[model samples]
Target: MLTSANLLLWAVLQLALLILLQEAFAWWIIAIYALLLLYSATAVLQKRSAASLKLANIVAALLTLALLLNMRQAGVLHFMLQILLLSAILRLFAMRHRHEARQLVWVQYFLIASCFILHQDMLLALVIMLLFGANCYSHYKLFAPAGARLNFTLTGRAVLIILPLWLGMFLLFPRLPPFWQIPNAKIASTGLSDSLDPGSIEQLVQDDRLAFRAEFSGTLPERQQLYWRSYLYEHFDGRTWQVHPQRRQQAVAPPTTAADVATASYRIIAEANQQRNLFALGMPYSSSQGVKIGSGGLIVADKVVSQRFSYSIESALAPLPLQSEREREMNLQLAAGNPKTSEFAAALRQQHNDTEQFIAALAAFFNQQDFYYSLTPPPLGRDSIDQFLFQTRSGFCGHYASATAVLLRHAGIPARVVGGYLGGDWHPQQGYLAVRQREAHAWVEYYSQGHWQHFDPTAAVAPERILQSLDMSLSDDERDMLIPFWQRSSVLQLLSLQLMHLDYYWSVWVLGFDDRSQQDLWRTLRQHIRLIAYSAVAIVLLLLAGMGLWLLHRRRLSKPLPAKQLLLKALKPALKNKAPAQSVSACLNELAKRYPNHAAMLQQLVQYYELAVYAGQPQAEHSLKRLLQQHKSSLAALNRAIKNT
Candidate 1:
């Protein structure tokens, strides 16, 4: 039968594996793992023997094959994780003795550590810490005495002692890049994509999840100025808009001097979206490492952003450079549909010959017409732009931007729809702007005389959206669709905002603390080198003193106590008149007769004392101490009775 200690250790090991891999693995894999754990627990409870090596080998082989087949879909990282978890589980099923499970426990430790690769937020980090503690307990239980239970007090004390050392190492240690980059798993990309279709951005705007955060080095920009451009949709089919293939293949453009002095310098901390496209304002120039300056002043990561990424950028609010002949041609090409909208654009162009005046007229059309911004727009056919312009005037930002870009192109002006975020909630206390997926917006950038100018027809339709937030422009019903029912309460909204603030600080101080932060720490330490050295010396002395005291206490505990001395101390109350050299047996016999209440205990004590002193048995000394303790109150009563007499 398995010992209770072993069973407990087994349970902890399985729990650690589950908690670590639950988020990373497929649901079916996790369900299978849970079922196996249940089976193992049932066998342990029933006192049945562990699975035979043959059965374990069969399961291992099947799981290995399944993982290999899934490797392509899950990627190499998840495949390795699955294999590691499988080995650990199979090892447990095949083991009969606790000692045989030692290697499995170590594997669980590694699995728990690997969880940080996917999750680094504050809440998940705490969960990971608890998993570590559970794994540590399991490892300790492997060599501990049978039936030993976990001592929470000792565990907490150990954590308290080690926490400082952990912090010290984390702060002081030189941060080095990973020795080898782990392959990114196939995760669903989160934000905008290379193509924009009708209702695509409308669906995205309903999601309130955080996309990225920006920390400005200078004064915060105006609400209308925070248009974070991510992707440009140059090619327009009748129904969808996509990035031109040649645009992506073009080389990085040379930096151009800004026409205006207005610039915003900021650092962006973007959540992992599994794409190389990054967010920035107009005409961004970045020298940040691990990022590339793409054509048309676009920023892109050197690799897929499989984790949280940070980059610093300086963006000029001026117009972009003049479009190349190929770019103008690409942006001007339109599908052979929306002829009614084309005729309307051509007539408007005829009324205003100037490019700027034509653009103004297009914006005026959206403003003067009965256009309503709605997340749920009516579906359109092949002539989407024509229908949206005349029949279905209700649409989201994508509809407005698409119609405006199409109108501009029809009027012989090179224009494209820009996909990115619009307004962000600026937390003045935190000094950062939080941009969410709900802020996903689409606008237009038209190539005019010498430069490209940004235009948003949605702003002309609903100016409050640019002036404030999406909520301001939306009705209660539309706003409710974006926010959850639970968060509609005023109290819950305030609480949620506070939690976001806490998370922001955690991300900035902990997850965002990179090699540059370490270098800054080193520089600060060098400036106060003498103070740091003194503090270090003081800490070392204190640690040495604590160790010296602990060693002394241990030495005192290790020294053996003499049996004769212990007997004398135990019987001092009853031996007031006894001779100093009296035989222990005689003394016990006299005491047993005088205090009959403790006669049995006195006799047992004398026997143990003799065994300890003459037979030299260590266990006898322990027995003597225990016997004396059992009869302590009676012996005291005997002493008091003698005193009264």
Candidate 2:
């Protein structure tokens, strides 16, 4: 029968695997794994025998086939995870002897370590640590089968002993790149895509997940200046706006702009979005390693952002570069639909001949009209711009930006919709700006006065969105629809903000500690090398002195007591008269019998000797010394009397 310890080990193993691989596999696969775990736990609780070898092999074959069939969909990373977890479960199911269980525990250690590849959040790290402790306990109980329990004191002592070594290796060791590239799992990407449908950004508005964080080197920019551009949508199909094919194919090195004294310098710590596009403010002039400037001044990563990524950038809050003739032609091209809206745009253009005047007219039309900014907008028809402009007049940032871009194009101006995030929550105390999914916004960039100018028709209708946040601009009903119920209360909202702050610190200090950080640490150590050397020498000397003192004290404790030494010395005369093999008790007995008048005192001496030496009584030694000292002359006379007799 499997002991309770073995059952606990298996339980923790299954839980760790589930938490690690739940996002990698499909629901059905997870269901199968969970069901198998439940069945095994039930059997172990009821003290059922282990499955036969043949039955275990059959089940393993089935699981292997399932995993192989799902490999393509799960990708290489998740496929490996599934294979590891399946093997562990099968081993546990067939575990009978101590050796097999030992092998299973070792496999579990690898599985737990693999969890870091998928998750690196502080809370998840703590959970992984707990799982490690549980596995260690299980391993301990394997050998110590007599009612094994967790010994926190011993565990703590072991940790204390190993902590310095672990820290030294972590800090002083070289931070090398991975020997092999790990494949990213097939996970869904978050944040903005290259295309902008009418309701795409509206869907994002309901999701409050973090997108990225920006820490500035100097003072923070105005809330309205925080337009984080990621992608430019130039191709409009009357309903959806997407990037032109030429833009993707024609990625050239960004022209270096002279850095102004007031240039904004900052670092962005972006969450995994599984996409190549990155976010930046205004026009990025220069970026750190592993990132490049792509077409239209957009930032692109060297690889897919499959993990948390940090990069520094210097950007100039200036007008974008002039568009090429091909870009102008592509942005000005409008689809065949939206004819009514086209006529309206032409009439408005006829009133204002200048491009700036025409753009102002369009903004005034949106602000003056009975247009509503909402998360839940009505669906559009074949011509989404027409329906949103003339009929419905109610939509989100995507609708307004789309209609405005199309209107500018109809009026002979080259215009495109820019998809990215807008205002962020600036945390002054934390020294970073947190941009979430709800801030996902779209605006228009129109070519005017020899350069591309940033414009937001949505800002004309909802100025609060540019000045504050999405929640501030939204109504109570819209806010309710965007935010979850738990965040409605002030207490819960503050608690959530606090947790986010903590996660930000974890991302910066722990996950963000890379090669550059280590180099900086080494540089600092070198600068203070002399002081460190002196401190080390002083510490060594102090330790040696302490050890010498401890050894001397132990030697003193191991030696004979002073009272016993005195007793041995006083009995030398009497012992010389007795036979060599005779014990001190026999010599004392002879003296007591001969000195009958002083027999009580001699007898007392014998009792004291027996109690102090044989019985190991400390107080009896003091009594013996007192009696011997009080009757020193009498004892000597008794000794002489015994010698004469």
Which candidate tops TM-score?
2
- TM-score per model over all chains: 0.81, 0.87
Q: Which tens-of-lDDT digit does each residue in 1-645 have in candidate 2? A: 348656756866676678676988889888878877776777788888667778889988988898889988889899988888887877777667878888888888888898888887788888888888878877787777576677789879989999999988877799989999877788888989978998999999888999999999988987778999999999988899998999998746555565453468999999989999999988788898989888888999999998889999988887687647787788999898999899998999899989999988988998999999988889999988888988999999999999999999999999999999997888989999999998899999999886789999988898888887888778899988987888889999999899899999999988888888889999999999999999999999999999999999999998766655665666666666678688777777777786687788878887988888888899998899999899888877776775776
Candidate 2 residues lying further than 4 Å off, grouped into runs, are: 148-150, 259-261, 542-645
Worst 10 residues of 1 by lDDT: 1-10
lDDT of 1 at 595: 75
> What C-alpha lDDT values do all the predictions have?
0.84, 0.85
Q: Clash number for every model?
A: 0, 0
- Which candidate should be chosen as best, given lDDT against the real structure? 2
